[model samples]
Target: MTSFADLDLADVEEVAERREELLAAVRDHAGRIAYHIARVDGGDYGQRSFSTDDGEWTVKYEAGDLEYLRFEPRGGGETYVISTQQPAEPKALAEALEDYPAFVAAYNDYVDSLAGMLDSVEASFPQVESTESVVTERDRIVEAIEACCDRMAGELRRYEGTEYGSFAARIDGTRWELKWDEDGASYLRAGGSGGVYVLSQYGPPSAADVREYAPRFGGFVDAYNDHVAELELDLETITFET
Candidate 1:
């Protein structure tokens, strides 16, 4: 599976730049608040604008008290939670600045992990390299397989009141199946209108049974590829009838 090191050089640099920019913005916001308090000494109030990864933020002050913070996103995504209108406590701004980077980092890690999942899926279930008209349909199926894998990897939660045998992710027009027993063994099968692939029974699934399952598929594919390589297999070894 590809790691962060394998990501495009430009992409990594971009993330670094974004992180730095956010930190700077947080500091600038804090500085503005401090300046207001100093200049007015309980007699001043104003607003300071700062940039964030999502959008521009306006920190408001009233009579040397932190009044509120508002964000207007560049991408127009809803800001889930805004600042409370009540006066913010001392050091609250410092704490917010301190946590800003950590929160962004956590979300970035999550997205990276999902991308890794897609890479693993492609690695495990490689598509045939061909240019024939017959191969075109197979290519489409391969794309669907990738999409399904990505969606599944993005969400690993089990539905409450749902049985252990249920798989959480499925693409429309594709069939997905999961079978498990009390002994901790499970099997996953997906495809149809896409392409057929089966993962034989594996045991001791981890982390809500989703994390271990994806890796298991990747491991199985890797092992199969190694075996095929050792056998010196080639496309010429197979005969197609149609």
Candidate 2:
């Protein structure tokens, strides 16, 4: 049996093709032995046995071992076993059994070759980001946005009057705006200068709006993060300038 452990590359399809050919040869040899046994028996002693090609018996290897041979009759019956003590009657079957160990070694070699190939293929793949890392990044972005909003709130407090007031910030070419009127009604926008408001409320600006419209910001964060990742930029390095 050939060993593939030291090979840098092994073609899985080629290994499988060789495996099938070797297995087929084993089955063919078993079939020939069954034919000879049936011919010599000639339906004697009322045993309704015939050649394997006649569909009377099927030759198969034992699962896992592949070295053990057995003949199963059609429609389910006892497995046919030839006695080694009566070597003259079923000499071919006994002789074939002796050659099965070599077949077993070859079959196992193919299995190992395919397994090594699978390992190589998997190792060559790029490592994917884990769920923990993804969630941590999202949380970091959210925290940064929240911190920027907190600073904006502090600046907005300076304009506490019955008049229209607005504060705007720019981060990484994206603009975020917060506007309030005499009635303390406020709205927020995060996009281009002319982008539509993302959050609008009749009363004063509340942190609850951030929670309620979190899905909206989450989508924005995902898109922004993707862009930054493609540019090989760090999200933490981005800051809002009001």
Candidate 3:
């Protein structure tokens, strides 16, 4: 339900202002942007480091000099994709790291801004009636569900000669049910549990009948499908096939 615009990963700024942080940010991006030590003070670039949303990470590297540092990246938790290498320029390395404090801070903030925006977007559209744009979309899915119910009820009504029917979305724990009786339609019901919720067709009473008229529920299927098609959700689409 969340959109990309709602996230603001760009809102982050580098917070590292210490000598160690400068060295760390350099090492983190070093693989992509190569660097190595010229001075003998740090001793063979073993403690590679960089800044992240929460703080910093310094992976202990091998005690060897790097002539051609390759960008071997690692995961940055939920915030960044990090990597490290030791280039052969102490002055340039220190300069880069010195500048890195602001750069890393700004860079991380940018990414965080986007993440924040996405978070905001998702928070806005939590359910069926959450968005105005999705109102008509809901109508379409409801129409499909009603159509399915009608088809199901038709079989029951034709044989049993009574008025009772239902339609629903079958998620693992959320079973939203729509029903109708002789007194007309009733309020919709949304069920939640740890139980499995699979999309399945009911009624028709017998397997032979289900095989015969199962195609009739396609309209309801389309209604639910179209409702999702309208939203262009990024997570997973409404996958209901019964």
Candidate 4:
């Protein structure tokens, strides 16, 4: 997502309040304290784009004297903010130690949480890595996909000769052709899983008004062809569910 150093304070004008607090703390501590704002890159901020619609937000404080904190509302309300500086309040020996330990612990937890968020965001929406894993995984998925396409060819022909049968095939992420007949013709497609299956009459209708009762065709295809404007799967695992 975004990098730590790359974060712009002006972009998150809302944090001006905390910035004011950090500034006051820096001034109060003066030469005894060192304050530099470090950005909150990677992790929660980047993985999940903050939303102004929902009310979920998180405050991530920076380590050391550079008191940085970010308020992120990735759920709905302007998600995620980050900044750096020292602890805002003076502490007695016990409180100072407690605060220091607490800060350290919180920072560590933030780091861990950020790591998990990175993993989750990656899982939900994968990033095309440009490193070594890129080529290796790409090749792996490509070979698997190629083998699948090859199989589809023969499988397609088998269905072609079958009597009034159907199959589902994907074209990118957009559309799928619910095909029938030895000759290419009509198909059904949708957006994602169980989106909507609309029949387009390319050839003859296997059974006219097929949608009236059930999706019937001479061949099979993914119900969501039109929705697959582009192919997003760098790695695809295909299993004939039905």
Candidate 1 lDDT over 86-198, as tens digits, reads 32222333334443444445434544655555454544566777656545544444444344443333332221233344342243434555444333224455553343344
Better of 3 and 4 by TM-score: 3
Backbone clash count for every predicted candidate, in the order shown: 0, 0, 34, 55
Give TM-scores for every candidate, taking all chains together and pairing residue i with residue i: 0.21, 0.22, 0.21, 0.18
Regions of candidate 4 where Cα sits further than 4 Å from its true position: 1-39, 42-94, 120-242
What lDDT would candidate 1 get against the real structure? Answer: 0.44
- The 10 consecutive residues of candidate 2 with the worst lDDT sum are 82-91
Worst 10 residues of 4 by lDDT: 90-99
Query: What C-alpha lDDT, on a 0 to 100 scale, does residue 138 get in candidate 3?
Result: 46
lDDT of 4 by residue, 29-80 (tens): 4212222112445222222112223232233223423333223222322211
**Candidate 3: TM-score?**
0.21
Q: Please provide, for model 3 over 13-126, each residue's C-alpha lDDT reduced to its tens digit, 9 standing for 90 to 100.
A: 322223235445444554332223222224655544445443443333344432232222233222122324333233323323333444445445644655555454544654
Evaluated against the true structure, the overall lDDT of model 4 is 0.35
Supply the global lDDT for candidate 2: 0.45
**TM-score for predicted model 4 compared with the true structure:** 0.18
State model 3's lDDT. Answer: 0.41
Give candidate 3's error at residue 51 in angstroms: 56
